[model samples]
Target: MSQKPAWLTTDGAPWGRGRARLVYDNPWIRVTEHDAVAPTGAAAVYGLVEFKNLALAILPVFDDGTIMLVGQARFPAQDYSWELPEGGGPLGVDPLESARRELREETGLEAAQWLPILEAQLSNSVTDERAIGYLATGLTEVEADPDETELLALARVPFREALDAAMAGHMKDMLTVAMLLRGYHMAREGSLPGALARAMLS
Candidate 1:
C-alpha cells in the first residue's frame, strides 16, 4: 500500500484564526474576511470565498476514443472557455450522480461507466471550492438540456488532441486541465482497462 509523504504524515504549525465577519453572500457562494496569523507567525487578513456546492466535472470519452467538450463564456474571466462538462452539485448530493447530470445537461451524453478520477481544492488560498472529476465512457447521445443562463457549444475531439490543446493553454479551466492530465496518467499507468487505455493513448 502507498503511504503519505513524510511532510504530510507529520504535524506542522497551523494558521490561527481571529475574528471573522461575513463580507458577501449569494445563493451560490459566501465571502468572509478574517483576521489570521500565518504559520510563519505573521499577522494577516484573509478573504475567503466559500462555495455552497461541490464542483463537478466530467470527461465524456466515447468508444471511438473521442471526448465531448463544452464551450461557453465565463463571467469572471470574461472569456470564452472550452472545458469538460462541469457544474455545481449540492454539497449533500452524490458526486457521480451530479456528474451524470452535468454530462447530460451540458452535452447530451450519458455514460455506461463512470470512474472518479480526481478531487481537488480549487484556488485553495482564496476559495474553499472543492471539485470532483470523473471519467465517463460507453457514451450514448441524447438531447442537451442546458441551463437558461448558459449559451453553450459542443465539440467532439480525440482524447489526445484535447489533452494536447489543454497542455498548450487553449483550454484554461484548471479542473478541465487536471482531469485531462489525470486521464492521461491513468491511461499510461494501466489504471484503466486495457482496451480503453489503448483507445485513449492511440
Candidate 2:
C-alpha cells in the first residue's frame, strides 16, 4: 500500500453518500471514480470524479484586439451558444498544441505569433481545471473543417463588451471570464504584468 497524503485524510468520509470505485490500489488519489447524487433530491447519479490533473482553457486573441471564440450547443446547460476555443484537458495533446488545434478547428484561424498571456489553476474549492490564456496575433485564415456536431460562429467583441457580457450573464463561460477580465489590461497594452499594472493604476 502506498502512503496517502495528510491533507487527503482530513474531514473524509466515504466522500459522503457517493459512488465508489477502487481505481488505484497503490497511492490514495490515483483513483478515478464517478459518483452520483441528486442536485434537487433523488435525482440521477451524479459524478464525483478524481481525475489526474487540471485542464486548461485559452483566450486566443488576435491582432486588432479581437478574441477568437466559438459558440456551440451545450447539452449540460441546455443552452445553445457562446464559448471560447478550449479543450486542453488532462489527456492527449499538450496545452499549447491543443490551443492551436482548437483555434484551427473552431475558427480556421492560425497564428504566426504566440504570446503566453495568463496562467491559472482552477478553483479547486469547486473543480479541478487549470487554464492558460494566450495572445495569438499575426494570423492567417485557412479552410475551416468543423466537426459534424459543432455549429460555430466567430465574433470580434471589444474586450470591454466581453467583460460586460460576463457581467450580464451573456458570455457565461467561467474560463472565458476569468482569463479575459483578469488579463484584460495586459492584452490591451501589449505587456505582461508591467504594462497591465500601469494601466490599472491609471
Candidate 3:
C-alpha cells in the first residue's frame, strides 16, 4: 500500500525551513535552532527540541470497573503526581511495547487487550515530543519490576472516582487527565461495552 505524502499530513502552508544546526544534545533529546521563512513570507528563527523517544501512556482497566494509578515525585515539577502508567519508547520502536513494559514495571499488571486511543504533539510549538495513549482491559496481576531510578506508589480506584479526582485537580498530569476524559467520552458514546460503561460510571 502506498503511504500518504508527508506534506499532505500537515495543515496550512508549510514553513520554508532554512539552515538548521544542533544547539545541544543529550541521550533523550536534541535542541536545534534553525532559520526559516514563515508561511507569511517573513524571516524567522525556530528553536525546536527533538525527542529521541516517543512518550507512552497507558490506562489499564480491570474487569471490576477499576483502573490502576501510579504516584511519584516529578523532577521538573518538583511535586508529587498521580498518573497512569507512562514511559518512553525508542523513537523507532513500537509504543505499545513500551506501554506494556511500563504498566508491568510500575503496577505489575498485564492486560490481554490493548487499544490505541489517542496521539498528541505534547508541545508542537517548541518540541517534537509525541505521545501515544492506550486503553488496556482484561487485566491480570504480575510481579512488578520498576526502573531503578523510580519510586512509585500504586493504587486501584473506581473509574468514576479516578475521573473525579482528575477533574477536581487532585491529579494534574496531562496524560492522566486526557486519558480519564477520553475514557469518560468512550463510555458515554457507547464505544465500550454497556455493562462495563455502566459499572465505570457507577
Candidate 4:
C-alpha cells in the first residue's frame, strides 16, 4: 500500500526581520499560505494550519429526557471524550442531512423530529474553521452504523445532568458546550422564537 495523501504540508522559511515564513499546501482540506511575524525573533514552526469548511454536530434530546453522547478518541486532547452525535462538512451533504445521518450512525437512534436550535463558528484563534450546531428531538432507537474507526458507543444522560457534566468539564468540546448552552436559553424562554431563526443566520 502507498502512503495516504497528506491533508496539508508546510515548508518553513529562514527566520529574519522578526518574522518566520512558510509555504503551505493542502488537498483534502483547503489550501493556503502562511507568513507569520514574531515581532522580535523567529520562533519554531508550530505546525501547518488548515483552512477548512464548516462542521455540523447533532444534539439528539429524546422524549425520555435524555441526551445522546458519543465517546471518541481525540489524539490532540490525548483523551477520549463524550460528545453528541456529530461530524464532518466536506462531504457536501446538506447540513440537516448530515445531522440526521450522524444521529443514526453514531447513536444507533434516529430522530422523528429535528430542530435548528443554534449555529456557531469554531477556531483556535490562529486557524479558521466554523462548525454548525443543531438540536434534535423526538428520537427512537435503531441499529447503529459505525464506521469501524469510530468504536463509538452511546451514553444517555438526563438534560440537567448533561449540563452538570458540562459544567464540570467532562464535555470538553466547545461546540458541544455552546449548543447545550443555547438549548438552556431556549428552555428558559419556554420557546425559541422565530426571531431566533433570523438571528442564527447572522
Local distance difference test, each candidate: 0.92, 0.63, 0.91, 0.68
Top candidate by TM-score: 1
Residue-level lDDT of model 1, residues 55-140, one tens digit each, is: 99998888778898999999999999999999999999988888888899999988999988889999998999999999988898
TM-score of candidate 3 relative to the true fold:
0.92
Output the number of the lDDT-best candidate. Answer: 1
Q: How far in Å is the alpha carbon of 91 misplaced in model 2?
A: 3.1
Query: Where is model 4 poorest over a 10-residue stretch in terms of lDDT?
Result: 193-202
TM-score of each: 0.96, 0.64, 0.92, 0.71
Per-model root-mean-square deviation over C-alphas = 1.2, 8.8, 3.6, 11.2
Per-candidate clash tally = 0, 4, 0, 0
Can you rank all candidates by TM-score, best first?
1, 3, 4, 2
Residue runs of model 3 more than 4 Å from their true location after superposition: 1-10
Ranked by lDDT from best down, the candidates are 1, 3, 4, 2
lDDT of candidate 3 over 138-181, digit per residue (tens): 89999999999999999999999999998899999888899899
- Which sections of candidate 1 miss by over 4 Å? none
For model 4, state the Cα shift of residue 134 in Å: 1.4
Q: What TM value does model 2 have?
A: 0.64
